[model samples]
Target: QVQSNGTALVAFEKATGKVRWAIGQELASYTSPLVVTMHGQKVLLYFARGGLLAVEPRQGKVLFHFPWRARIEESVNAANPVVVGSRVLLSECYGPGSVLLDIDQQWQPRVIWSDAGKDRWDRSLAAHWCTPIYVDGYLYACSGRETPEADLRCLDYNTGEVQWVQKRTGRCTLLFVDRHLLCLNEFGTLIVLKPNPQKYEEAARYEITDLEYPCWAPPVLSDGILYLRGRGRLVALELIPSRK
Candidate 1:
């Protein structure tokens, strides 16, 4: 658990709720911690306010720390790090757009590519809060800080090259299931998209009635039911057709 003071991450025992280990004085960010296997070892990656902290899960020892944050005071590291094999991608809508880092054998981070230069819109991705989804060798995400500037874009994961952009999608969250992308925009509009790197290919769209705007929460899928939450409402829709 992240401390309320944003100064530490505490690990608690599941049954007794006892403190297991606490490490680092780095400020916490909204991005959640991710556990992945790297080089035949388990690594815990946390994108704190300072940057990405790679830690050993069992002993709570810090392995490596890479500084990757914006220069502004009000900026945040909201998007969770996207990891594929030995490389990890960190993205934000602030000054630093996105960076791809390659973690080598010694747990050292080396910059593969960075799009944190001029021409923000031309960068691969500048996601505000939604984490980019990795599929095959591409990335799919809504790139922008605000609603008016938001665009659903596809990018080459390795080279940080923009493949395609679907304009005016607004700030949205995505869920990939059954080889299809389920997008729920901030304005309560749900869109089904076929994941294609060459162009924007939408399969279907629906305006979820009675669901208010500012739908920042990502859609949840469970047992063939799609759950959507908006201001003052929670909706559940069945996606799989009944066999009857």
Candidate 2:
């Protein structure tokens, strides 16, 4: 849970429901905290309103706090940090487009690449809320704050270089499963794509007629059933065809 001014993260005993540890004064963001292993230790990465805070999960000890949010007052740090080995990627649509950081042996962060001061159209990826799907050595995501300005893009993970862009994709979320990319846009359109770094390759597309606008929730897969939630309804599609 998060508070306005005081401690942000609080750990409670599951069986007894007692407070174990509380730490930090970082304000809340929509992004969820992620636990990753680095340097043979588990660290909790929380993208708060002020920046990224890395903490030791068990004792709530602060490891490193890196400021990486936008300057504007109305902006948000929505995307969850993407971690690949010792490198971490953070992105937002406000001003800081994306930044890749290398975590050293001492847990100190070093900036590898960033598109912070670039033009909006020239930035590699300005993800509004959806986190980029990292595949192979590339990142696939919808970049932009709104539906009209958004585009599906593929970028090189190391250099933050744009490889390809599929325009008019709208603000969409991506899920990779079974060697295919599943994209669910805000307008209730689901697109199946092939993960190709060289070009945009769409395999199939379908419109969920029952789902309305503002389908911001990512698609959920459980027991081979694909579930999509819209503004008013939830629809489940079974991926495996029924036996005759």
Candidate 3:
């Protein structure tokens, strides 16, 4: 297991807690590393403050690095990288917008396209910290700055085109399940909607009045139980289908 500070990555043995390897002396971002298989080998992708670094897990060898960060000094890359097929998708709310990188057979990375060239705030999907979920060749995520300005959007995964946007939804943490989106808003309202790019379709909604703080943590589902976190409490709700 590896842990990251604002600078440097330290890998330790899980059972013995001994240092196995240590690499990376660059500034770090809030995003965690994603272990993925690219080009038939397992590699760790770290979305650091300066860029994205692909590292060999066991040996801590730096494979490649892709620069991605906000031009503003205060902005940081806090979202994890999304891997699709042989490509990697990256987006953040701070700097420019999103970028797509294509990895070839030789493990070299190339920029397929980038939305950061557009007006900073006008990018297709400016995700703050919440990573997006890809469904049927499309991306569904909460896009915008924060709070009232945030919107739930569906965009073409390959083209980065906005297919539809649902406004006034507040900042949301989402989970895609069985072709549906489980959106938990900041106000603790849970909304179930179809993940349709053509239009907005609501299936059900429930407001958890006991929540004391904004539900910013991502909603997690396990064994038919949905778990959520608020200011000081954790909630688990059982998901049972309605009787026919």
Deviation (Å) of 128 in candidate 2:
1.0
What lDDT score belongs to each candidate, Candidate 1 first?
A: 0.90, 0.90, 0.84
Among all windows of ten consecutive residues in candidate 1, which has the lowest summed lDDT?
1-10
- Tens digits of per-residue lDDT, candidate 3, 1-244, equal 4555423677778999988888776786788988899888898888888788888899888888888878788888877888987889898887777888998877788987788679855688888888888888888888876787799899888888889889999888889888899999888999999988898889999998877567899999888888988889999888865457
| Candidate 3 weakest ten by summed lDDT | 1-10
Please give the lDDT score at residue 130 for candidate 2.
92
Q: Write the per-residue lDDT of candidate 2 for residues 1-244, one digit (tens) a residue.
A: 4444557677778998877788878777889989999989899998887788898999899989988878898888999999999899999888878999999989899999998788888888899899999999899988999889999999999999899999988899999999999999999999999999999999999999989988999998888889999998999999977667
> Once model 3 is optimally superposed onto the true structure by TM-score, how far is the C-alpha of residue 115 displaced, in angstroms?
1.4
Better of 1 and 3 by TM-score: 1
Model 3: lDDT equals: 0.84
Would you estimate the TM-scores of all the predictions?
Answer: 0.95, 0.95, 0.91
lDDT of 1: 0.90
Name every residue pair that clashes in candidate 3: 6-28
Q: Candidate 3: misplaced stretches above 4 Å?
A: 1-7, 241-244
What is the full ranking by TM-score, best candidate first?
A: 2, 1, 3
